[model samples]
Target: MTAGSFLARLHGRTATGVPRWAVRVAYAISLTVLPSGLWRILSVDLRVPLMDAPTDGRPPPDWFGGEWWYVIGLSAVSETLAFLAVGLVCTWGEVWPRWIPWLRGRRVPILAAVIPAGVGATFNTLLWPYSMIMISLGRRVDGGGDLGLGTHGWQVFVFYASYWPLAAWGPLLGILTVHYYRRRKAAESVGVREDGARSPAVTVSH
Candidate 1:
């Protein structure tokens, strides 16, 4: 099967009643994380000069001390976590996957998902905008200004352009989390009513 069809089927099985816009936003969250991940990977893995050069004639700290694998691992971990945002609108967030050993087929506790997502949203909300302003002022226009990534070169401008989208990541995740909570709550209420209706009535004999 083609990749597109495969992804559609995969997403379809997990999510029910998720709004189209929310799913789109989930995808956007993944996209927003890609550029910085790529930049980091390129700089570290390929030994490319994508990052800012050393300031003050002192060498930049060896981010893992020149270990290439560490850089790759960091990038992989980051993108994987970012991709999990899709679960907000997908079925897997509500129901445990069958592949999971003991938890399979169990109804996922709503708060289990909501709390972490909500916390992440709050943290990212505070972090990304400040980050963007710093990048815009420090790197984009300021040529190694103290507030932003302190690298000077044409590459710095490219870096700013690529990483700027990350500023939107926090707000978008916050929006998706709100929608996810509402839909899950509504579904939970409906499930509770269904269970109540199906329950057998008890009769007492005197």
Candidate 2:
């Protein structure tokens, strides 16, 4: 394709640039994280293991500051991530939300999201290796526990069973991020810039 058309196509092709595999991965990861986020919010138990010391294959009883407080904190973080997932689907990632007041409905610069998301996806993909290291060798810096269910045979088993979901998340996000970038480059080749670039208009997906 000519440079102009190639760039022009970015606006439309962005949707496609995000591969089906990545889309499904984003959906799966977001879905799994959503329930976990909700559970973290509603549950009274924090169940977050303390990483004050190195793990001994068993969590320290007092690792979490406390069950309830820990749960609340964990819930907030999970919900934040869940909300961020909307960026993957919506142009809001390209603009500030109306609820945001002063910057409400303002266009988000591409650099803002791409730089972070691209880098984030890169590192996030690295998590697979980290996870493998944790399982095979162990962690060097103690911080927190993986979001496994509990310290029971079934709990561990289920943790493993569901854990595979996250593995898919990173690669999928990488694909999506790459797709977004290429599409953006193409859009630049054309004339369609983001909302704030010239006008304050916003475009919603059909």
Candidate 3:
């Protein structure tokens, strides 16, 4: 398939009647954490010194000592979680994929997808803003009061630019979850099964 065709299939509408915009948004959600994840890998694992080194004649933090495994693992897990948001707009979110043992091809319960995503959305929505607030107050949500970027304007700019996209992650996921819920609920209400077949309408004799 051509690239355009492949992309169309990837983001195409499924049985859920997801809008094209929503599919795009879901894809965007998967990318929201990428910058920060890459920043961590480059700064911590690769020791690219994105932040200023400590000036007190002390050695750098343990993370800067090439914590490749930890940094890579964290970034991997974060990106994987972000990618799960795509399921909200894909067929897999409504029906289990064929590879699963017993649940293969089974219709996924609505609550199964919504509850965790909803909870995650709520938590992330609160968490990032709270973190920014704490950072602004010169307090650290993760530990130290200082960000360790020192007084370099370029360093601060690059750091924030890499990390700022994270603030959109929660809101995007939340919106996508609501879209998933509405589409699925509408399908269920109209007796449309996961296969897109509608049940025969009932009639009452007068």
Best by lDDT: 3
Q: Model 1: C-alpha RMSD to truth? A: 4.9
Candidate with more favorable, higher lDDT: 1 or 2:
1
* Pairs clashing within candidate 2: 7-186, 46-67, 50-63, 94-108
Q: What is the Å distance of residue 145 in model 1 from its true position?
A: 6.8
Backbone clash pairs for candidate 3 read: none
Q: Kindly give the number of clashing pairs for every candidate.
A: 2, 4, 0
Clashes of 1: 2
lDDT per residue for candidate 3 within 1-206, as digits (tens), equals: 89657865764344457777987788787777898889888877776867667889663465434557878888899889988888898788899988888999899999999998999888888888777666655667785767544425676677677766777888999998988898899998889988778888899999
Which TM-score value belongs to model 3?
Answer: 0.85
**Minimal lDDT window, size 10, model 3:** 58-67
> Runs in model 1 with CA error above 4 Å?
2-4, 9-14, 51-65, 139-153, 192-206
State the lDDT of candidate 2 residue by residue for 64-153, as single tens digits.
366666766775775465345446544566657667879976867667767777776677568754664464332322335553323454
Candidate 1 vs candidate 3: the lDDT winner is 3
Q: Total backbone clashes of model 3?
A: 0
The Cα local distance difference test for each model comes to 0.73, 0.52, 0.79
- Name the 10 consecutive residues with the lowest summed lDDT in model 1: 192-201
Candidate 1 lDDT score at position 39? 79
Residues 118-143 of candidate 1 have per-residue lDDT tens digits of 88878877887776785666543234
